[model samples]
Target chain A: MGNLNPIQILVDTVSVGGLYALTALGLGLIFSVMRLANFAHAELVTCAAYAVFALSGQPVAVAIVASVGTAMVLALATERLAFRPLRSADQTTMLIASFAVSMFIQKLLIFTVGSRPKPVDPLPILAQPIAIAGAQVSLLKLATILACIACLGALTYLLRRTSIGLHMRAAAEDFTMAQLVGVRANSVILAAFVLSGFLAAVVALLFVAQTGFVHPRLGVQIVLVGFVATVIGGLGSLPGAAAGGFLVGALATLLQALLPAELRPFREAFLFLIVILVLLFRPNGLWPAPGLKERV
Target chain B: MTAYAAAPHAIRPAERLSEIWRRSATLLVLIAAIALLALLAGQADAVLQRRVIFCLVNLVAVVGLYIFMGNSGVLNFSVVGFMAIGAYTSALLSMPAAMKGTFLPDLPLWLGAMQVPHMLALLTAGVVPALIALLVGFPIMRLSGIGAAIATLSLLFIAYIVLGNWDSLTGGQGSLMGLQTYVKLPVAAAVAGGAVAVAFWFQETRWGIALRASREDEVAARASGIRIPRVRLIAFVLGAFVAGVAGALFAHFQGTLRVENFYLDLTFLLMTMLVVGGSRSLTGAVAGTFAISLVTELLRQTEVGVTLPGAAVTLQTPAGLGDVALAGVMLVIILFRPNGISGGREIDEMWRRRAGRKHRKLPEERNA
Candidate 1:
């Protein structure tokens, strides 16, 4: 702890935090209106990662386009086929359908491409660490942080100033009431998912850049982390989801760096203990919407 | 949407008792049918006997899932977390003294120097996870709906990480081995039968009714004097107890404790079983476990190679065919029967509908 540089750790924390927060924001977008925690988000992220790997040796710009495009298509397709039919189903039922879609897609990928982890080249030059002030940060880390900021900015602007954003806000508050009041249900849901898909692609690209590998299971841990962060942030609250994601990401990184060496291996256990404490303090999550009181 | 109407205010005690008995009797028949399957498997082949035992173990876990998820109407994704805790606890306490000496040198003298009998270890396994669930439920149960599900998921991750990395305790990532293969078809079938009976009985009790009422409408249940969190906590602990027993049975049945087995893959498998079979009743849990296990068995055989009945030609099957087929079937079930195969009704209830003693009412107004 004494030798650790505070600035370096901050950068590390934010980079990881940004990745998680971005993923959570994507998930929160869909969940806000539809109460469905799409397990297929994992698939969408994996689709993006594989796109990058499949397009290796291409220009970075081309690879990014491929990754983002694949995620958007898969996200849109699954929403149309699996989830749309279950639109009026129970949240649990919709959640299960998402799981089935996830499993089906995962197996399909495994069968079609083989279940091996392929090393991804996210541009070798971009892999190098660059010094800023007294701290060193990898180009990938810098990119992830910047991408998160830009995407978050764009998302905020869209939500605040756009007509679709107004519809989305109304829909999230009370989807049925919003529809009853003449909000076009399909377009709002569609826009939320499309933006969500784009954010997922962003998360996937940053994650694959950091790890330099892509596999069918590539997005499992990230999705898990982001899901928890979204929960901790508060369901149906965009700002809460973002805050929760950053908190989890930072806490996770901080725990690893701060713990004594012998306890490092069990860092996750400690993190979980903290999560339990947080739940105890704020059962509806840290930023639960004031109007949505806990009933059960 | 219509306001959720309140349930009828009163029912006679005699009527309640008879209703309970009817539900219990139907579940007993389901158990007996499974027992018959176990007997037939034992007579067929040794491999089938072991496979049947595995199915029974899975039955216990899936029923464990139903106990909380069905009654509470909360989709819990953390039963395997309790299972892992139970299995690891049993493995450590039940390991032979000599092996424990070598494998877990850091184990304190008391736990390492002794090897408890299997039954005692199993009971301890059940109790430990129950207590852990109670502790976890203190916080997690306070949150309802999606928040509750996600918080419980954190518990699962915590259990997995601790079990995977605590090398001296768990052998750290390597499989925990040397567990006695003591769980036979008869033993597992008996335990599973007891699990069904326990679940059925629990659902009839005051706590169970209160929890189910809360599931239907938390505000109405609360208004009627149900302590929502307390009822949920009771179900959580009770469900963890069953999961713990299943975990003990699994460790003995599989002869090893691989932490990875208790993670997401198994969690999803058991949950799918619950959902497809119907997450609301013991019949669904039992039927789902049986159906999925049978399909998996068939798939496993063909996953190597299959020969045509008349033609001599052999066909190579792909790996993960079972998972693919099972998931596909689950999707179909969700599409056609969103309430599950049993449609959340008990066996006797289904029989009543078939006999035309009860007419089908409109489904709860939900989006399709």
Candidate 2:
């Protein structure tokens, strides 16, 4: 085995972290507004991947458009169907319902499109190796980093500079108060779901491009990591969620590189251990939403 | 103040005694229902008997889950993880020394050579996971709501990774076979009955009441001097204990063990059972288990084409139909009847209300 390259490790960590950040943002946005930890977000990613897979023969732009469209529709549908009825229910109920929705979609996918993984190449150009400063990097890694940065920058501008974004921030801070101040709860929530769906679609496209395969469970692990990040960032804090995502990705990469080869397979266990420890120290999260403090 | 308290105290013991009786009756009702099923299973074919036993096993796990989730109102995703620990622990201790040496040669010398009686191994299975929960719960029970939920989910993933990769003791991805097949209908039913009683007794305790109060309103519970985390931790460990025992029962029932058996599929199924029956009461837990078990069994049988007695039509369903149907049923229940089939109330509560109504009606007729 060759010696580990620091720059290469940095690139891999950022690439993985970028995907997780997008997923975390999606989860965090919905949670901030509705107080629901939406497990069905996994299905959003899975649907997008499947959409891309089914449209693999089409141009890359078309596949992207179709996948994004499918994810947004599914997200909006689940919100309208399963979640709306239980909108006033407690957090646990909504969470379990989301899991049901997640499982429901996964099984539906399996029924419709077989359980076996199907290989597809939507953007084969991204798979090529590129050298940067004495280290080998895939074009996919660079694209992933750039895409993540662009998404993050655009999201920041939307939240800070846009009126609807201001309303969203207000809702996250206090939904009742925001509604009292003339924010339309339904439209704001719909906007959150649409954006979440958009993020899931982006992650799905990148994930499929990297792995070259699509399966019913392509999103479960990603969602799990995203969920942990959401928790670590503070339940309803968006920037905190993104940071937690990068933190997890970086920690995982470091563990993989630093631990002895025999212990490498246990990296996920260690990463989760650290997550539990973070909760122990910061039970509310690194950046707890301000509204949570009012509860006590 | 003393005189005012004394007046109520005079009537309190009687009220408490009746309360105890009522609660015991609820447990008796649950046990009797399980016993009836066990009796029916005894008279059935081997396959049917095994299926009923599995339902009883699921009851144990669900009731264990209900101990924490039902009372604390926190979602715990680590139930299956503790089950995995319990299954592997029991499998290791109960397997013959020679077989352990052959398959799990990397186990510690003492563990590799150990071959305990089945009952003792089963008890140890429950104890081991309880100890782990005691350790893990200290950190986990501190967080509330989604924070605690995600922490527990991480715990589940951690357990999966470790159990699946630990080559020596668990045989890695390979199945561990040749365990004593001691969990029959009687055993599973008895254990499940014991679990129900344990859950009921705990729920009636001061700690359980306090935990539930906190679940209703954190600030109010704290105002009443409840140490929320302490009670939550107590329930978490106890729940883990019961779940662990359930896992051991499952291993012995099947006479085989694999890491995959304790992962997402089992987690999803058990969660469905808990949520469908209602996650807030012991009765709901038992009802949910039986209900989903019946539903899944019916759906699975349909997959092979169930034939109607008088009709010429046979219902043919595709494979994996049961899961899809189960998910759909769970979603509908969560949406339309969020409190679950039991409406989150115990069976005795319904009985009491009906009895009270009958008594009231008699007085009304006399007055008329």
Candidate 3:
């Protein structure tokens, strides 16, 4: 097993982490602006995967557009109906509401599409593979990494440059002050949700392309992973969430490779142990928002 | 000092009556319903009785939630983790030798050899989870509000991964079987009743008051010389113990345990029960458990047909449809009455109030 190719594991690590980073970024963006962790972000990703699967015969670009659009709509509706009302309420209410929205959306999908796992065909672009660094890397993985970087770059540009992004930043910093400065909190929040939904679509495509199937429970695992990444990066920091995603992704892969054969199956558990340790020492997270005192 | 002494005299009669009703009626109904359910269980079929017992098991879990959410105002997303610990621990301890040999060959020699009695094993299960909670709570309790929620959620993921992979102890993805089915309807009901009664007693105690004080205003509680972290730690540990006991009961009742059975989905259901019942009251805990459990059962049992102009649509429900429906209804209730059905009162307080009124009249007549 030690003689087995290291390159394959490395490739798997990067691809897995890249997918996680993509989804975690979307969740982080919403958290940054809205200060509410969108539990339904996972379902948004699931919704995207289903959208792609439903549009299988279409052109790849068309399928991608439809998936992203569907996710955006779902995000918008979730924000308007579930989260918007609770935003003014306490944090616990919002958190519970997000869970409800998550369940509702998942069940709705199950009711419509059935609970069985559905086979998904990878887009034509992902069908090819390229040899790199003494290993075979699939086009799907390479594209996932490239697409994630592109999304990251685009998000960075938007948050650092665009007016809407500025309003989002302001709102995240202080909602009351942002409102005082004439930033429409609701619109900015909606934008955050839309952006998150778009990210989820990208991740869903990548995940389904790799796994070749989609299920109602797919979002549960990803949501948990995304949440851990969000905590590792910094609860409300976009870059931190991305970094955390890749970090956990890489950690998970490494543990899978390095753990004794008997312990290999507990890779995710090992990663969570690391998270618990980080949380213990750095309770504020790895990159806590500056100038914010502990609320307690 | 003189002005402060006159405060009780200034209290209005109407305000006092409203306070009494707020705290007592909710508990009265809860106790009466429990008694009614217990009585019905004697006459009910095996299947229906099992469902009632399931509700009772859930009552234990929600009682744990009431301690943390009700008293501390913190949303714990990992009650299922403690429940998992409890379930797995009890299942492993009480599993028969033949079953242990097949799935848990790698278990430590002593654990594999030991076949502890069911009741003792269940107690051990509860203690193990409590100990884990104590260790986990030290740092986690520092996180307030949303941060605590996230941290505990991580704990849930961690627990799931461990339970699923620790094949030696937990039997991995396979079901752990051969445990004695000792948690019958009577035992479950009694445990549930005892748990609710214990919670009520705790709520009126000094530690409970301190925890509530911390929930209301951490800074104020700290200034008042309350050790906030210590208070939260105790609440968390106790909550985990209760959840563990519930898990133990759950394992014995079902006669098998699976790791997947106690994950985020179960956590969501438990949270719904707490929110729907009212996080603040012990009665709310029981109420939420019964309401959500019964509603879930009804939804799964009820069949619906919709006739349209040219077509008919029929829906065949699955086992846990009621849980999902109750979750939906509770979401609406949470939006409106976030405090829950009873506003955080217990069942015993109702009878106590009536009895207190009669006693008060006798004392006044004797004094006159």
RMSD of each: 3.6, 4.1, 6.1
Off by over 4 Å in 1: A1-3, A290-296, B1-21, B358-368
Off by over 4 Å in 3: A1-13, A291-296, B1-32, B303-323, B346-368
Candidate 2 residue pairs in clash (backbone atoms < 3 Å): none
TM-score of chain B of 1: 0.92
Please compute DockQ, using alpha carbons, for every candidate against the native two-chain complex.
0.56, 0.78, 0.52
Query: How would you encode candidate 3's per-residue C-alpha lDDT over B1-368 as one tens digit per residue?
Result: 02112123454668565654544455456556776897798799988888888888998889977777788888897789999999888888888877788878989988887888888988887899899999989878878866788878878888888898777788789887777789987788778877776676566567777787777678898898989888888888888888898999999988988999998778888888888887866777878888888887767556343344565655556544554576578678867777677655455444555466532222113333
Best by lDDT: 2
The residue pairs found clashing in candidate 3 are B27-B346, B27-B347, B278-B340, B280-B344, B281-B344, B296-B322
B148-184, model 1: which lDDT tens digit per residue?
A: 7667778888889988898878888988778888899
In CAPRI terms, where does candidate 2 land?
A: medium
Q: Which of the predicted structures, 1 or 3, would earn the higher DockQ when compared with the native?
A: 1
Stretches off by above 4 angstroms in model 2 are: A294-296, B1-16, B357-368
TM-score of each: 0.94, 0.95, 0.89
